[model samples]
Target: MMIDNRLCGSWDMISNDNFEGFMTALDIGFAVRKIAVLLHQKKVIEQVGDIYIVKTLSIFRNYIISFKLDQEFEEYTRGMDDRHCKSVVTWQGNKLVCTQEGEKKNRGWAHWIEDDKLYLELYCEGEVCKQVFKRINS
Candidate 1:
């Protein structure tokens, strides 16, 4: 089935799994990593025109970020990153492809849905991190 671009709108992050072991690999302190791993993170997404805003919320800390699809721009990954990046994202089939260029090499992410399940793949420095989430409806 073909998806409307609006399908990228409003997504809730129900669950997440780290694949690149970035938290541990990046030497994130045990305390912070512990909290991050244990805490439930909810992602709220909104699409207005060609822009997308993603908000990662939790008890310990909250992060708000925005990106434009298919349009390259400077991105500052606050909370998760300290450096600046050049990024762009576009849709491929049912999946969203993201490319981030900066201090880290081979950084990008892809998002998609299947069987009502949410999938996220984050990449950095040749390491690929994958996370999957099931949709929750009330």
Candidate 2:
């Protein structure tokens, strides 16, 4: 359950691509989609031993996930899709890969550090939303 400690920091969104498409694939309503697309996001990742806390922050809403690596837990996408899913996160090489099992097909996300930038790929229903974040703290 060891992780790359370098990922523990504050990150600001640099670019988000195809986020609307990804939200549409999740069956998100138009109103929320519009608001979500307009807001920039910040991420704060903290780790202690094998436990990880990931916070996705924005003006409109925030989503947080806390769990130990490789441990299965119930995750409710409350402010987002409002779906209940069993989720587990584990490392695939240097990337932190999370697989969510529930109603949707191919639903998951992966975060990896590349060239000092935090890269995130959100997947659901064959749609992939790619987002990159730049470190904001020394």
Candidate 3:
């Protein structure tokens, strides 16, 4: 199955829940966590054939990750959290599910679009962070 092209665009974060817990699980420092929680995050997704480039942009920092479907790649969570992970993204129905293998257990994220909003379910260890983004530009 292919990822819905509707997911390609720029989305602005509207709500974030349990993000602090998720950041703590990643061992983020207290100062960084505080700054991170306050920043408005934006997600930009670009799809070309089977390759996908996903970028998370914020005033404090930006994270850009690129990968092809079903292929594993080395992912470095640089500015967000300093972690090295082996990550693979695949399509599950219309949702983009990513599995991350590294020091943290149960680390992954799923992205799906519902109505006019984009949803992201980020999980690490036992903590789950839910973020909702509204379409800003397409």
Candidate 4:
């Protein structure tokens, strides 16, 4: 079977290994984080040529970002980093690699699949959060 790689997707946050060691990392309060933890995120990804727009939506909040592959652009991490930074994403061996440049060091993230399971790794401030998700059938 062949996979398009760019399509509407859904992910359930099975476990969040928030590297921040606390919910304050996003600058949100405990209550918000609690709700966020329970949030079921639906990802809508649209790619046309070298450009892509990805949206992460949930009842709690929604984040939308658009960028061109391998091109450097300014990104504002509204709900995540909450800062303006240079960002870029490219495909590396079937995995999507993203790098964010800003005040924080060692900041970047990657998404890939293994055994039909989706995985996400977020890094910042020398910390990393490993999250696992399982795809569901529509």
Candidate 5:
């Protein structure tokens, strides 16, 4: 139940790549996708006991997920994709990897720390969106 301390903090998005392609693969509307691309997303991760709470924040919208490692949960991606998913997260080495199963194929995301920054790779339907975030005041 001990989560990695490196990921337990606030992070601000510094770079986002291939986000449009990723959104397109998810069948998101053009208008929503446009706004989503411009959003400066922030992540706040909190761990208590065996549970983890991850909040993806933005001015346009916000998404939150809470679960324990190695456990599956029904995830409703409310403001993001508006889809229902069976999601499970597990630790692979120092990286936290999540697999989402639903309508999309090859859907999942991973979070890891590298070069003093937080890195995220969101993928669905053969499209991968890579995002980098910097820690806030460490």
Candidate 6:
């Protein structure tokens, strides 16, 4: 299967659900979590060959993670929830699925595009956060 080039673009967050629970699962402080929920999040993805650079940008904090497909790398999620984890992102059909192994249980996220929108499902412990983004540029 061929990867869709449309996945490389800037997406603005349209909605977020259960994000507070997800953040709480990550042990984020109440003040930080409150600020996080109020910030408008934007995601930018740049895919070249098998390498991908993904950025989550907001006024409160910004995070950038770069990795090659099927390669495991140490990811330090700073500015957001500060944690270190071993992460690997692989392609499942047309969706990008990531698995993170570390202190938290069931920690990972998946990214997929549908109907000109980008969907991200973030899960940790029993909490699942769903975020939808509309494509701003491709």
Runs off by more than 4 Å, candidate 4: 1-8, 19-31
lDDT of 1 at 90: 76
Q: What is the lDDT of candidate 5?
A: 0.93
Residue-pair clashes, model 3: 0
Give residue 84's lDDT in candidate 2 (0 to 100): 99
lDDT of 3 by residue, 1-138 (tens): 466788889999999998999999999999999989998999999987778999999988999999988989999999877889999999888789999999999999999999889999999999999999999853
**Selected candidate, larger lDDT, 2 vs 4:** 2
Show the lowest summed lDDT stretch of 10 residues, model 3. Answer: 1-10
Error of 1 at 62 (Å): 2.1
The numbered model that scores best in TM-score is 2
lDDT of 1 by residue, 39-131 (tens): 766656667666677676778888876776667988887776566889887778878787888867777788787766667787776566666
- lDDT: which is higher, 1 or 2? 2
Per-prediction TM-score to the true structure, in the order listed: 0.79, 0.97, 0.95, 0.78, 0.96, 0.94
- lDDT on C-alpha atoms for all candidate structures: 0.68, 0.94, 0.92, 0.71, 0.93, 0.90
Worst 10 residues of 6 by lDDT: 1-10
Clashes of each: 0, 0, 0, 0, 0, 0
The CA-based lDDT of model 4 is what? 0.71
Best candidate, lDDT-wise?
2
Residue-by-residue lDDT tens digits, candidate 6, 17-130: 999999999999999999899989999999766778889999888999988888899999888678999999888987899999999999999999888899999999999999
Candidate 4 clash pair list? none
- Candidate 5 lDDT by residue in tens digits, 50-129: 88999999999989999999999999999878999999999898889999999999999999999999999999999999
Error of 2 at 101 (Å): 0.3
Q: In what order do the candidates fall by TM-score, top score first?
A: 2, 5, 3, 6, 1, 4
